[model samples]
Target: MSATTYDRLVEIVTKLHDAPEDRISPDVTFAQLDVDSLTMVEISMRIERELDVHIDDNELEADLTLDATTKLIDAKLAA
Candidate 1:
């Protein structure tokens, strides 16, 4: 993924987690960020609304890390 895509992921994750942008990393897990299922769903919805991309539950489950999530968003944007 491009650096901008990764940066966008970090921004979105930070917003969802209510944490500092620097606190989120590619290696960090969502669980470690104390993000619950409902929050995850809300985040997904926000991404869809903001980015105009659809991300299903399975994709969210498969892409747990920030890097993976960024890649997924990049792919959707490309598509």
Candidate 2:
């Protein structure tokens, strides 16, 4: 995955969840970060708004890591 994409995802997730930047990493999953369903929706919306990529709510998985999420976003952007 692109470092730029990973960095932006980390920024969005950290800000939305009020999580410390240091606590988030490419391998860390949303579940590990204590991100709930509501927060997942919020994250999806924020990603669409900020990244100009639409990620359906169903597409967001709590078990997905930041690296995986970045790859998804990259695929969407490519499509």
Against the reference, the lDDT scores of all candidates come to 0.77, 0.91
Clashes of each: 0, 0
Cα lDDT of model 1 by residue, 1-79, tens digit: 5448777667676777786656678877777677888888887887788777899977786238877787889899998
lDDT agreement of model 2 with the native: 0.91
Mind sharing the TM-score for model 1?
A: 0.79
For model 2, the run of ten residues with the poorest summed lDDT: 1-10
Error of 2 at 32 (Å): 0.2
Off by over 4 Å in 1: 1-3, 20-22
- Alpha-carbon shift of residue 46 in model 2 (angstroms): 0.5
Clashing pairs in 1: none
